[model samples]
Target: MNLLFVASECAPFVKTGGLADVIGAVSKSLATTGVNVRVLIPAYPAVAALVATGKTVMTFDDLFGGRARIVAAQAEGLDMLLLDAPHLYDRAGNIYLGPDGKDWHDNDLRFAALSFAAAQIGLNGLGGWVPDVINAHDWQAGLVPAYLRQDGRPAPPVVMTIHNISFQGVFDGTRLSALGLNADQFTQQGVEYYGKISFLKAGIALSQKITTVSPSYAAELLTPDFGMGLDGLLRERQLDLHGILNGIDLDVWDPETDASIVATYSATKLAGKTKNRAELEARFGLTKSDGPLFCVISRLTSQKGLDMLLDCLPDLLAEGGRLALLGTGEPYLERAFIDASNRYSGTVGTIIGYDEGLSHLMQAGSDAILIPSRFEPCGLTQLYGLRYGTLPVVARTGGLADTVIDANEAALLADCATGIQFAPINGLMFGHAISRTCALFAKPKIWTAMMRRAMRHPVGWDLSAAAYLDVYKSALAP
Candidate 1:
């Protein structure tokens, strides 16, 4: 079957988070199963450099106040349809934000245009190759189904996948006409949310199927806690929703073959991992320790529960554990972590920015990875840790709960314990989780066994792609 993916970002070319990785990996994995996948992403500088040289399949005289065209290209082993609109997509540094550190004023029009283009492609096949199914990812591509519905054409079935429900593309309801939204469709039953128009809600309300990054998150979206104000609509469309777990690109994340890490290692041969750990300590200016070395590779946001981690840091250091953190987000969290690094000195080392290579080495080197998220929509770092034999210490929520088998006695006895999981997201529990991890690390035999088990865990996309195919088949059903 031929499939088209409409997403804001894709791996290697442009990425702000796991959504891009998912798009790139899913396309490749689905292709292995005989699915012809084409991803439609904005022509950011990196993508434009490669895709601008490809065939121009479709052009627009005027789309959302600018001339635009779609360039079909193949790069990095993936087929992509680049929306080459410089006026909308061309900028330096961050793609979504301007130099002023605020969202670009034209974001609503920008992504709406992307969705509008997708609707066009769905209605009129590109280059005589119509997509059998269109998978719209995140709120950026949320209006694809709505645009198709507005066109009133027999379009390919659209599957709206919510990578994170918190980022719904909501704007003024008064700008419905500016967005080219049908005035008649502005009721509560339509794209209307409170007094505004939410692109994510429009997609959820109009699409044939809905999916989240993980099954556990799929269930979480039904409750008020995780719904982010759209639980009512999600409850209404519960039958159409699916919770398909996400998988990583195993080839890219493999510890043995990854060129980004300082040393190569695997489940069977873990000697190199020791070398990597030493190298990681040196990079972060951290002191070597006999205790567990924990790494955090994530956005430093409250939603990630980094503050709680800060509270547990003193205890972690008191227990002889070491930390190496690499990420940037939220001004306060960044300051706090920096402060901790200074106060804790050799025990805590923090990098205030993101480095892809450093992240890979951290996973390869660290004895464990910390992901105590208050709420997670299927984190990919934990999966990468699992693949690298770095046991994950995570919160018991969303995909973290679904993926990691806690190192409880039952799981340990079965020799299938992969990582540590803590519940009741609070400082006390988080501290206990850290202490528990330290205790587990003290047991060398059990710790090594768990690492091997984690490395053996299936974090690849084979099963996930097959599950996506099944969803597509179901959507195409008469």
Candidate 2:
């Protein structure tokens, strides 16, 4: 099967979240399975340097508005087609952020150009190779299905995966024409979301099939709270909706193979894990304690339960613990963490920035990892942490609930167990769970057993790709 992925970002080339990771890993995995997978993403200024020269494909015009060109490239051995829209993409900073320090007010216009470009690519064919299925990720690529359906283009069937339904692209309904959307599309049954145009809704309403990142998330979208106001539409299309759990790139996360970590260890031998913990302590100028070291590497956003984590910090630190955080978002949350670091000095260290190497090291070094999201669509960090032998303490929501199992339960049934799962997302509960993890880590035998269990568990992309292949076949079937 020939598949073309349209997403806002792709890993290594560009990334802000798990969407990029899925796009890059899944494309490569599908290719390995004998599928010709091509990717189309914006060539943002921050990532343009990563694409090697002489890979520029021919230029083309946007199907909706503006002129655009595609630069051909390969990332981690996967063929890629970059949509080069300098006027829309070549900004001074992150793809979503401008140098002026705010999201460009014309985000709809920019991504609309991307969506139109993707439709044109499928319609015109790539070097006489039209995609069997054009799969889109998140709301940015949601427009692909909308354009294909509304523009009356003879395009291949489209499948849009909702990584997180909460971020439905709700713009002013009046801007439908400017977005190249027909006014008719602004009806109660179309892109309109409570008087606004929702990009994700358009995709779900028009695509051949709708898929979320995880099965648990797939079920959650039927509810009012997690649905982000599209539960009814999703319930209407429940038969067409699916929840496909994401897989991590094991090659990039294996401690033995990874070079970013201070030390390496395997399931059979965990001496290096101890060395890594000490190294992490020293790097962060933290004190050596027998209590488990819990690390949180995520953007300080409310969606990620930053407030809840902050509320639990004092109690966690008071109970003989340490934290090493690496991420940037939500200034108040950042400062709150910084304030905690100031008060607890050696017990807590916060780095308000993103460093891939540091993240890998955190996974390698921490005895336990923390992820307490209010509603996670699918979390890649916990998967990475589990693979690295850092038992994850994640909330029972979305993929986190599906992936991580309680430590005691995991040991009772080693064959089907992985990490820790907490329910009733609250600060007190989060602290209690941290306390439990610390108690388990205090015992070497139990902690070692848990690490071995986590390492043995598998969450690779092959299984996920196979499931997606089934969906792709269904989309293209006569």
Evaluated with lDDT, which candidate comes out highest? 1
Q: Write the per-residue lDDT of candidate 2 for residues 86-199, one digit (tens) a residue.
A: 778877767887777577888988888778878877877867788889998888987887777777867899898999887887788888988988877787767787888888
TM-score versus the correct structure, for each prediction: 0.99, 0.96
Per-residue lDDT value at 429 in model 1: 91
Q: After superposition, how far is residue 196 of candidate 1 from its true place, in Å?
A: 0.4
Off by over 4 Å in 2: 50-52, 55-58, 61-66, 409-417
lDDT of 2 at 171: 85
| lDDT tens readout by residue for model 1, 322-413 | 99999899999999999999998889999998888889999999999999999999999999999999999999999999999999999999
Model 1: which residue pairs collide? Answer: none
Instruction: Provide the lDDT at 415 for model 1.
Output: 92
For model 1 the TM-score comes to: 0.99
- Least accurate 10 contiguous residues by lDDT in model 2: 408-417
Q: After superposition, how far is residue 474 of candidate 1 from its true place, in Å?
A: 0.5
Residue 320, candidate 2: Cα error in Å is 1.7
Evaluate model 2: give its lDDT.
Answer: 0.84
Top candidate by TM-score: 1
- RMSD, candidate 1, Å: 0.8
